[model samples]
Target: MTIAHQPLFKLCYDEPYLQGTLIERNNRFLCHVLLDGSPVSCHVPNTSRLTELLVPGAPVGILKASNPNRKTAYDLVTVEYKGTTVNLDSNLPNRFTQLLIEHNYFPEFRELKLLKPESTYLDSRFDFYWERESFLAKKDPASEPVNGNSCLYQADTLTENKFAGYIEVKGVNYVENGIAQFPGAPTIRGVKHLHTLMDAYDQGFDAAVIFIIQRSDAHIFRPHETMDPLFAATLRQAAAHGIKLLTASMVVQGKCVTPTLEGPTIDLNPV
Candidate 1:
């Protein structure tokens, strides 16, 4: 009915677009493409190491730039490999998850109030912060409002403990075989976030890290250990210390996509 009560955004990239073959990635943000057999420069939205997905001659989907003065006339939207589409925009994952959580799509996070966006904790700024308050019954006799599928009501409440939560979102595009891995390149920032989450978890707060796999090809999720073993080790330690790790895959429909979470098997100290 209202914007605040709206549903989670469904995957839908419903726009006038073009199909092209990727010719070459000039750098992190620019790629040469063959559109209708004519060479053109396209903007690659996600700068991560697209490892196996951005092979030359791969089918790519692009959205025409509305800005006439822009250097590149198209924004590379998706790369198709064996019928799978990866959202090439690194910027969309966090915003998409925010839409999901605000619309109560996540069962684990539903009813948890969205306190702030880009909340800072120590040196890191998280994607979100939610409040989870548990009231004391003996201290009061009246009821208060609550939201959840399980604990939708609270009665005879008094001030008790309120926990602040943090969510860090990671966009995952690099998949090997059937497994999705992150940090397609070495990331000093990612390692720092894992350690921060672990520290927050130890500080009596609910802390979590979410990996939004940009495509559906991955059957499992793990750290790209071979690429960044230090980060992988830190992530493993965080999980062992009770920091919540979530893996959700996007269901992309022509650029419109919603996330679907899956169970993860995170292996650290792998043999």
Candidate 2:
């Protein structure tokens, strides 16, 4: 219930999740719950450890799937811990980042155009693709910086324009003492993303990875090297290769998400 004065946004599922108490996580993708003192099986949306959030008898919110033919009708989506609600949907981060870009939340990308989602490249799928027209700061009508001042160009003019090859979004849930860490478990897919991001950069197009902290507790974001050293090493190499890194700390207000507090530059030093 922490409030802020920045622009706000939220993602409401098909319907508000039904209140329930977490009986137990039966498996990585399933769980048992108590809704109104009756036992009911539910679906766990994410596969991460979520060690700090989910607990026996903890308050939870379950989403009811429309298809009644499914094994479990409800999908566990939200969990409350230490007075904060954490979103557990594994597929929501990309959508949330898309909305943020559309709203100009990141001033660096405010002028982005031709935003595309779910772009598939060679052996890899990215979250977004976009183009931005940038003109050289002209002291004269030449292709050079004019005392580091910029000028504008038409949308049709591709000269000096930057086409972003890919943008990958990562969701963060593991947090402690205002520090957010990623990859609650080892991730091979994540290592692939780093290589792809670097490849995109080498292809003469913009590329970056964005990490969205699903809870309000984290003040900064860092890689969980202990959990996945290979991903950490690849991430460092990707950074060295000029792959951009962006982080945002977002809060869940009831069933909605507000404009995130964009995190500072990442701490690449291995921990």
Candidate 3:
């Protein structure tokens, strides 16, 4: 997937309201520039989740819409804090991103697995699994070829008829100015999830922390170090421990959104 005809907008710091003022009117708002210097606005749709982070003087990314009837002139997209502009309202975006990487539909993924309590422990049924295997096939003249090939037969590649590894998925919503960031707010739960992935790696299972970035403009992704330092630290630890850290972005197609992984990984080593 590709981002076509991305509009270029400016950071209107000259305007009085743009100069670190809050949105007092009904539909207006101030957004922040992302880590990559992109404009974003915290609009009404995102107000409930963004109000706390979008305080005065918060730098944001703004996209000027061509539609005159739209309530706000600019879309409030992200907020900058502690030298980082956290992308607010990333929930839906994250979901779309995950779909691109894993190719799992939203509905299928939700009901794909359930955790059942077994002996005081919650056992989770993973969404997917992976492994490396070699194929052993024999030529049979009477066999019909699969996919228009008449000579060979394709078969499942596994050992003892069981999967070799298990993996879980997590969606991410956080971006600014086309640059994706995670945890629009400080998320203790996110930190815990990283720890869980680390645990899975230790327990001989292949695990990953997937960030599905919502916005098409984000060229890259990073963890929100400013919002939650602990989460960042744990993410680094997860990487070091071999919990594959992955990311994918979403493509807006008409009224629908699709996930696509093309953005580079964010490196936030503790510094």
Model 3 local distance difference test score: 0.47
Report the C-alpha lDDT of model 3 over 1-271, residue by residue, as the tens digit: 8667432211122222232333332332333433233334435435333544555555554444556686555554444454543444433443343344344332222322222111110233333443333222222446554335332232323234222334444444555555566666677666766676565555454465666654456676777777778777788888888876766555543223444435556666544
Scored by CA lDDT, what does every candidate get?
Answer: 0.74, 0.76, 0.47
Q: What is the TM-score of candidate 3?
A: 0.48
Best prediction by TM-score: 2
The local lDDT score (0 to 100) that residue 248 gets in candidate 2 is: 79
Q: Write the per-residue lDDT of candidate 2 for residues 1-271, one digit (tens) a residue.
A: 9775665577667765689999889789999989988989898889898876789989988887888899998988889987778888888788889888888887656776567787665577788866663422212354442223222222223332444346899988888777788888899999998897786566566678989888888776789889999988898899889888888766776566775556634788977
Q: Candidate 2 — which residues are off by over 4 angstroms?
A: 1-6, 133-161
lDDT of 3 at 244: 68
* Residue 242 shift from truth in candidate 1, angstroms: 1.8
Candidate 1 C-alpha error for residue 142, in Å: 24
Highest lDDT: give the candidate number: 2
What is residue 90's positional error in candidate 3, in angstroms?
6.5
Q: Considering only N, C-alpha and C atoms within 3 Å, which residue pairs clash in candidate 2?
A: none
Better of 2 and 3 by TM-score: 2
RMSD of each: 7.9, 7.0, 13.1
Q: Identify the superior model by lDDT, candidate 1 or candidate 2.
A: 2
Model 1: per-residue lDDT, tens digit, 49-126?
A: 886888899988888888889999988888897788888788778877787777766666876644466766668878
